[model samples]
Target chain A: MVNSFDVARLAGVSQSTVSRALRGDSKVSERTRTLVADAAKTLGYVPNLAGRALSSGRTNRIGLLVTDLSNEFYHRLIGPVVDRVDEHQHEVVLLADNQSTSDIPNRIISLGLDGVILATTTTDSVIPYKLREKNIPFVYFNRIAPAVPADAAVIDLTDGMQDLVNAIKRNGYKRVGAILGPKNATTGTLRANIFFELLAQNEIFVPFDYRVNGDFSIPAGLEGFQELMSREVPPDVIFCANDVVAMGAINAAHVYDIKVPEDVALVGFDDLPEAKWPIFSLSTVGFDLEKLAAVAVDLLFERIENPEADFKTVELPSYYVTRKSLP
Target chain B: MVNSFDVARLAGVSQSTVSRALRGDSKVSERTRTLVADAAKTLGYVPNLAGRALSSGRTNRIGLLVTDLSNEFYHRLIGPVVDRVDEHQHEVVLLADNQSTSDIPNRIISLGLDGVILATTTTDSVIPYKLREKNIPFVYFNRIAPAVPADAAVIDLTDGMQDLVNAIKRNGYKRVGAILGPKNATTGTLRANIFFELLAQNEIFVPFDYRVNGDFSIPAGLEGFQELMSREVPPDVIFCANDVVAMGAINAAHVYDIKVPEDVALVGFDDLPEAKWPIFSLSTVGFDLEKLAAVAVDLLFERIENPEADFKTVELPSYYVTRKSLP
Candidate 1:
């Protein structure tokens, strides 16, 4: 309940002096700063956060806009972002970007956010355009808008795809089917292209009907799995776009009374935490998303500090995790 | 980025008038209010959040301090809390309260949080003591301190447990082992007592060796399941401390190649979203956690508005959810 004014009054110092001392401004002598600090500490006096915020014109706060707050993937992403933001003495305000119809940029500006981190922007997203027009400093998270070039932290799925193909070929699997994400998604496009390209190099051809489409949801994966099962002859192995999709496929397999690795092999992308659970233990390719998030946070800070800095895209390497879900 | 000063300058009014007009505060003259508002909209001017925060001495922001940000249960609770907070033109600051042994309250104050919703407090938690001493407004979310008796939203599992007992009896599953959380926890003690009392009513008992204790985590559930399995004859059914613990038990069953319901029945508490997933359709106690969260958010605001308001406790009813996991 105690404010800086109370500390100033107790220390017999002016309010401005208290502010200067607290901020460690060079105008205030070291002795005065120490005295003010001691009194502040003794009284448990904290600066009026509201007043300090007004003076600096910065709340020392950043906006973290995520599309899906409930997604397991997003939850994993939040951990690293929080750590990185906290390290910079900045607090992140979560903005659940519900739909395209939401007035996100305006809300972010109204909140007086120092900067915005677009962790959930899509390729066709108008969020970046609006933010850029407003001159509101923003850094893209995992996904990116090619038309609006900004700093981003992305995974290059190239290496992982190569390994995925090599593994499949060595395991003597030819009939392969893929449960991919939405066609419009950059992650989907990149992942699928890279996967097929690597497969072509290994002389592994995928049938057109073997591909199933999903929207990166568990239900989507389940539907895709059913599509594969309904085939005249189900593929020997099924590759999912992401772990969420894979889990859904496995769940569908259970419902269909199909055994994993015995009847068919399952592989997933994004080695999420649940992938290693004793229940699933799914085999998949994974990168350190936590590190990627930290880098994204740091990138945003860097971009905010140096707006003219060249846009740099950091690509993290991925590796396959061997588990019971795959042979 | 334009502030009240810009709008006031354009509208030929004082900054105070601009603030009153923008906020729709009644003291401002209607003509002046309209002119100020028009200028604000035309110029796309947004109020300096810090300046408004300074004058009001309040930020419409509440903190939800929780442990384990990656948990699915938290995800389910967050949506309702966010909805209620947004209705008050307020935001919930997500704080990961993972450091269980740290000075929780001091850290909260340091963060300059307006108020906190304690979602993971134990009965003997020092956080309540510190907040009470500081006269900081906080409400218990899904957890309560009976000693302090502040505003709380707790789930009464009596009905759920009663139904569970009856179901167990009717199904002819007599031996019931428990995977309980920490002994000092309010939920731990409360649920344990209720379970024992309800079992006594049905004349079904659990021997001392049939119990396994740990934190409310998946590993704890696995360990408890293993411990129970080591007995001369494992219990026919296991009642977990919560949904997550139940999942751990289920995973353990899978690991040991035991079937659910047929070989052993597993029942969880707090029917999380994952509980309904086809992979793990865990039957557990169901309650309106979304509504519970909204109540907790509303309680914090109520306390903020009227600190002298009678400290109240809210208990919500829980019911049994029969699924494939249980007979």
Candidate 2:
């Protein structure tokens, strides 16, 4: 419990001088800085972040707001983001939007974060507007809210979808079923629109009853697949919103004793690590997930450092990764 | 960015009065508190946590120190911990020990956290000693460092191990290969000792060459399985350290075209959500993960509130879950 005052007493300097010296403020002389540092290290005095933040208006803490921590996708995303943030000497404060409370913006504000990386914002979320009103710097990750302009790192699924459509056409799949994510999410809506448009252009039409939208969850995929299969005529090919959903669909297929690719082709987006597992071997739209995380952290830091800078959106390209799931 | 001064000016009170009223100090008049609250709401002022922390040495922040963020085990653990911490009106600060800097203890101290929950401490780690020297309160989650005694929530593998050993005896498996976790971790060492002791009691002896120790990871499992299978006489059954490693072994078996439970039986610990997946259907030891998280968080909060209380360790019991992985 050694405090700055203790270090100051041991170093024979004023408490303010000790603070400045320990902070490496150039105002303090080199000799004073060394003396203070030695004294602090001897006493094992760890400077409190709150006091430092009060003096410098920076907490060196960034908020990573994710919606679902249980999702496998976030499992990979959180690690890279934490590593990158650590490189900048900032800690990550995990914030989950799982609670039904609408005071998430206020919670973020109360934490006194330097900035936030919004990994779970929906297209219609009011959090962005509230944050804008409070002048809190934030950057969108994977999803964006049009109500407020901000920096974002998102994926362009056009090329990948095109390649997937080509595969569908070549495979001569007559009926196609889709299990999309929630409509409120930009990732879901945009991916669905692009997929449907591409499929139409390729003369592969999905009937209205063949499409289902749910949250990006395994249960949703499982139920969606069951519902689609019970239809009068099931689609030979099923497109899942993401790898998690695809895995769920595969699990459902296993329960029903349906063989993958041989009986029904399954394709997914976001080729997460599990997609490549020998058992899953899921065909998915792939992108550099680590790169996406790095870009998002970069954008958030940029927004924090240059608050008045022009809002920029960095869209990373995606590609199709063919595996055993697709015929 | 409305400061306390703005609220004080609008409320016709001193800045200190405004602060006291907002913090619900008993000395402040109810009428004055209402006036300050109204003014604060009107100005949209969010109290700076730094200022609050400086005044009342509590950050209301709890740190959850984890070794591997990419591990699916943590993915499930983090959500429940976050949820439990949130119920106490506190935020969770995620601290990963992935860096080789050896300054993790210092980093925790610098964050000014009220307490920490250690989820990944090796038995020989110096972190517990450092935290104890600093008088920082922490509770062990899943793993513990025996050097410094503290509150902990651990698992007891006796019942589960006994059941599993009974299953092994019933199946009449003569040769056994094992993929254990790191020798440095208490979990790995404890589980291995218990399993081996139980097997010895039942007159089942594993040859020295059939055991491979590794970190609790998929890659480790895969590599360990490969190494074991290459032996002149490969064992018929493989015991994985945990579910994640079990998955890697399963993947390796699939790649080598080895039929699980037919060519080789696999048994894993920590029956993770993926264990019951139709693709995996792994037989493993099961515990209430959510309850463990809650107990850890509760122990942390208890220690934070009463630092002088005698350290208590709550050991949750585990059970064996049967599936296709084990014959």
Candidate 3:
């Protein structure tokens, strides 16, 4: 029940000054802000989110819209996004886009999220348009919708793919296979484009049978790898869409008793924590996923606070991590 | 601007009936509820959570208070918990217990959460007390606080540990090393008690130097295993506090070039999804974590709707999973 009045009384400041201080308005001096904050802490005063939202038009709650909650790849982003949101004095509302449930736009409005970070927007997704119609600010993380442009943080896989192709060439693996992600997704298409272009430039061609499409999942990798291996002339190497798929491929290799880097080499993108485990040591295209997630949060907050800010697309650097999987 | 009145007009029902139908009151007949829901959907009406909270005293948001956000072990639980919550027309607000930030109880109140599910309560944690003081309904998940009794969903590790120890005896392995979890944790203490008691019954004892305490983290497992291995006569087998720690021990074993099941067998608890990866196949105790998380949410909702109901403790079944690590 503690309110700004109690904090102001305890801090010996005017009620308006206490409100401004608590709201992080620059008009309030640091000394007064600290004084009010300390008093608020002592009084155990927590500004009601609903009241604050009504008064300041900000809920301090950001939604992270993920399409696939079961995917472990999304799991890695939650911690980093939450950490950065917490740094900005905000909390995360994990919004899973389940088709069976109510639409995401309704959930966002119902929950009163200040902004949203779309981590799994397909190129043709209508979510961005819905968000724009509602005047809800959103930042795309690792994916983009050209139809409805917004702030985005995406990976530049050009350099990493080149390094991986070079490594493949050096190892003299001619028959190559690939488990590509869905062509509808920007992340999947971009990586596939870079991967195939690099390999084609090196006179390496993956047969149609060897080129399988997955949903960037573990089962996709397992099934794709198994399908490739079942062929009369199996591929000597498999390039997966991402680490989760690559892990599946590795597991499949184990099931078939195929030695990594000996029977068939595997390379993955994203280089999730599991790829780095000593047992796997999966060589993968690497980027700071934590940093990418954090930046997406930062961009979303910036857009929320400054709606007039120019739309930005931050392309982070990537490199190939040479590990036992390839060597 | 579309409100219950608009839905009521479209559905040819009274405004209060629309409200009751939207709030899922059983008093509203199924056909009327269906008509109201369809009308609301057609109008794209999102009931304002703040207004609804003041009127109905329900926020439809649940806080999942976790101590460690960076751990992958917690990541597996989030998806299932969110799915279950969404099934009941609720959303999850991920709340991390960071001391540098505002206290959890204050955050809970500020966020206007209907209930909370405490997933990481150490035995000495003050969170339970704070929640009780505020009369906030909560359910303990896989952990408990003796000072404050509440509804809980936890695994019964007694039978599983017995099976594990019996397998250990049958294998004729001795000079066992253990990485026990923090003694202050209910989960850690309970598991350790079962482990040691079973070993004692089998006339096997772990030397003081062989038994180490960890905080149930990856680094803790790595350090504990390394410490045990550094002894002049290292134990033939190592039991970790949990799956995360067990993975650490397995990684440490790989680092020392010790062949699993040949040089030192490894055992873990929890049997996380990663433990079943073909690359790992980690021997561990198994329980239905998804069910456990879902039941915690269920218990919290039960307490929220029927606060006078006697608190119930749901003990889930557990068993031992023997995989390549033990073989």
Best by DockQ: 2
lDDT of 3 at A174: 96
Candidate 2 residue lDDT tens string, A142-203: 98787788999999888899999999998999999999898777888888889999999988
Say which prediction, candidate 1 or candidate 3, comes out ahead on lDDT.
3
Give the lowest summed-lDDT range of ten residues in model 2 chain B.
B94-103
- What is the per-residue lDDT of model 1 for residues A150-201, given as tens digits with 9 covering 90 to 100? 8888887877777778778878998999999887777776788888888988
After best superposition, candidate 3 residue A98: deviation in angstroms?
3.5
Q: Which candidate tops lDDT? A: 2
Ranking by lDDT: 2, 3, 1
What is the Å distance of residue A110 in model 1 from its true position? Answer: 1.4
Candidate 3 clashing pairs, residues 3+ apart or interchain: none
What is candidate 1's DockQ?
A: 0.48
TM-score of 2: 0.90
Each prediction's DockQ against the real complex: 0.48, 0.62, 0.60
Q: Model 2 in CAPRI terms: which quality?
A: medium
What residue pairs are clashing in model 1?
B66-B97
